[model samples]
Target: MAFTLTFALIAALAGPSVAESRDELEKKKNGVNSEITGAQQSYDESSKAAGDAAAVLQASQAQLADAQANLGSVRGQLVAAQALDAQMQAALAQSEADLAQAEADLAVGEQNVEASTKEVISFSVESLQSGDPGLRAFNDLMNGANPTEFTERKAISDTIADVQLDRLDTLDATRVILDLNEQKVQALRDQVQVERDAAAANLANITVLEQQAAAQEASVAQLVQANSANKAAADAAVAEDAALISALEADRARLEAEIQAEIARTTPPPATGGGGGGGGGGGGNASGKLSYPLDSVRLTSPYGYRIHPISGVRRMHDGQDFGSPCGTPIKAAADGTVISQYYNSGYGNRVILNNGVINGVNIVTTYNHMSRFAVSPGARVSRGQVIGYVGTTGASTGCHLHFMVLVNGSHTNPANWLP
Candidate 1:
């Protein structure tokens, strides 16, 4: 009898030990599974980050290409300006040469006229002082010149005078031409100077472009480094996830072994039907009057501080946006009467629902961005009833239900209350 008692006591202690071991294994398995899930989430986030980095790198590369193109354009302009400067210089040189030739011709003409005048004066003195008649006549003939001779002499003198005059005239014309040429030369010089200045400016711009390109290259390098880091992080996360999954598999195997062992040890266990009966009690006194607007959908904005997306300025979002599609249905969150539903500047199409009391607190909901309103001012509404259709109208990006819950005119995040 003592032996039987000892055997029964040992069996009882061993049975509990087996059960405890199984339970511990199950717990470990669950912990491992959790770890695996966490690791997978981390891996996914890291992968997304790597993808974003790659996208940024691609954008940077495109920007670099554009910068290089602009640099090439600037260089082309500089080259064109230099070519224009060279052409202007050639024009100026030709103009100077023509001017010099004109001046030289004028000087030679003046010298020839002076020599002719002296020869005529010497001949005239010799004719008037001669002693012999024939000699005197000859001198007189030489000086006065007979009809034919004088005519010929006069013609020669006239020719000389005309030559001188023509030379003088040529000089004057040449001077005029020189003046024009000089003006042209000055103009060409000015043009060349302008071109040179433009080239210099372009060179400066090129330098700036080069610097900008260098900066962009540096930025690209930085992006590359960032991308590399992101990729490494992603790889690490993947490796960690793999390790966690392997660990979970091992833990599951251990749990199965323990559970099998527990089954083997337990035999002919007493069955208490299907466990304990689930107890339930009836009840009650649940009575409360819920007074709230049902289909009130009118409100332009909500009361709260919000940052402007583009400007990054912090301002109060006075109301909510509620306008939907042209004929979309709008609903009221609670039972309330519509206080006002009118078009305003900020609120294109608006509706305001005043919920009397929700959980012992007076509440008001505003809906904006509505296409049209089914109810009018002072209209009653019920909960979960369609009041209006959603429409994207007035200061709205798209059709969305802009629901707002206000407590005493103060705005709160609608996401917290809406189901």
Candidate 2:
């Protein structure tokens, strides 16, 4: 009896050889995890840089378009100014011609006045030399040959005085017209100068707009180039990370295959009948009497149909989430063989256990978002054994246990199985 008890104690204390093989694999997995972490960090930094570059490119493109539009408007202004300048020049030329013609007409008027003065002086001298007008009139009346002849001589003298007065009036009118022409020419020149100044101002504005457009174009080109470079870097970083992850997964698969072989070679001795009755533990017993997977449970999410937080798609939620502090110890829900432990894209560090049949239905439970594993594949674990720790790994928002139960390969709500 003493020897038999000693053998039983030894068997209970030591783990199977298959478990030893799993330890080596877990160590390699940790190494691969470190590499994945490094790759993910690189990818995140590159993606942020790419996003910043894209923002700069967007702003630069908008500025470039505005500058181009402004340049077009400025060019139109310049064209309009040129047209106005040409019109002003033509007007100035016309004004100059008008002034020149007015001066020439004044010159002709002055010469005519001078000739009229000479004619009046010659007539005065001839008339004075010929006779004194009042004395001759009186003599002719006293010794008149006929009254009709005397009346005709008086009428001729009156016509001569009228013609001399008309010449003086014509000279006065010419001087007035010459003065008006000078004023008109000065006013037209002032108008031309104002138009010229406006044209110059518009041209200067157009030059500034052109320079701005050129500068904006250069900025846009630089930003676009930077954006392209950043995008390429981001793409390459993501691709490299994907390749590394693929290679690591392959390694994990091979290691798992070996673990499965080791389990086959070192299969445990079979039980003859039902092993145990209900026991006090943190997890379920062999009788399918379930226990809480943690010492204290706070439901973060419930199992049901719901919209996904990230993708916003309606899908079935196959698990229950329990909030926990980071690195909190997690227990197995029932007696089970460790089926697999690996990194999952959505589940992070995961461990799935086949907990044997319950009520004629195959019961499988999964623990996800673990920081690391405490057990290994192919190891037999009793209820309440430490299987892993809580973490925010693999598509998780925070530290939590995503606990799931499956029945015969189909997912079922974990809440239904939990007490």
Candidate 3:
């Protein structure tokens, strides 16, 4: 019994009657529409997220710029410090030279003082021992002779000794002056040493500053690299967002087309036995009128001014073509009275229906390329009802339904009339 029931259920599901359920078709159509909407929403959210990322990247770039500027400032300071250090080094070297010169001057002064002392001692010995009368008298006067002799000789000797002594004193004064100059030089040397030490300390500071500058520069470089990477990511995100938008748009268009097709399939055919003429009862209902003349067919040609497929020339095409198997069912486009069902030079096996007077305006619909007609002249039909079958009739090419819409007998693009 279970096996029999399973077989029955499978048979029921496989049947054409089950496959053609309107509710199932509607559900599938809604599902497609829903997918399209969901894709569009996700695309929008991704785009917004990409924009936010871009903003963050911009801020990071700005920060990187500031970091670079600071690095440059540090580098400048480092350079200045290096220059000052060089100058200080030069000054220190000069100071060392000055100190050496001061020591040499002091040595020279000491040597001069020793040489003057030797010369003074030798001159005194020579004055006492000289053989000349004045020198001998001078020497005797120094030894304390008689009063008159002592007075004259002592005066001459005293005068000579005084002169010699003054010379020695002058030499001694010169040595003292040299010693003072040496002291001044030593003082200058001390000052220079102090300056040199300070300069060395400053050079050490410069070294530290250089290190800081290098670190700053490295930071700037890192920031630059990071900023570049961020920008690239942001650009990629933007591109992805754009691509998603395009995909969403395409999906939306596909879903809209499917929805329109579903609506056409499910809606009941318009009544052919209408009170007034023209495609359908006018006003808003006209907008909802079925657009396609047939179902389950591929579009062969679209309505508009198009290049003639055979002639390769710009030509005005007044209708659309739906390629279908021969004898495929064609239906009335809208509720309207059948105005004419006849053949013509260009349109063979054609039918013209007056839709109705809608908003006080008359509209007509035309169908061509019929293999066989189901309705007769003056017969009424409803929308979606098979009125004829597809054929390659009238100025024909392949098997297709040639459909047209006329507003007051003027051919217009059929897409405008169809949903």
The window of 10 residues in a row where model 2 has the poorest summed lDDT is 1-10
| Highest-lDDT candidate | 3
Of 2 and 3, the candidate ranking higher by lDDT: 3
Clashing pairs in 2: none
The alpha-carbon deviation from the true structure for residue 294 of candidate 1, after best TM-score superposition, in angstroms, is 64
Residues 190-236 of candidate 3 have per-residue lDDT tens digits of 88879878897887888888788888878888888877776776676
Regions of model 3 farther than 4 Å from truth: 1-15, 121-160, 267-419
The backbone clash count of each candidate, in order, is 41, 0, 15
User: Model 3 — which ten-residue stretch has the worst lDDT?
Assistant: 1-10
lDDT (10s digit) by residue, model 2, range 1-419: 12222232233236444444343233222322333343344345444444544565566667657666766676676567667666766766676676667667667766766776677678778877887554566678888546676677777767766766776666566666656666765665676577667657666765776676576667657666655654554454455446545655664456455434444554545333423211122244555644567888999889875644542333356678899998999998887656567776666887766665666665667888999889865566788889999999976778899887766556667777777
TM-score, one value per model: 0.38, 0.44, 0.52
For candidate 2, the TM-score is: 0.44
After superposing candidate 1 on the true structure, give the runs of residues whose Cα lies further than 4 Å from its correct spot: 1-153, 267-419
Model 2 misplacement above 4 A: 1-30, 48-153, 199-419
lDDT of each: 0.50, 0.62, 0.64
True-structure lDDT of candidate 2:
0.62
At residue 215, candidate 1 shows an lDDT of: 69
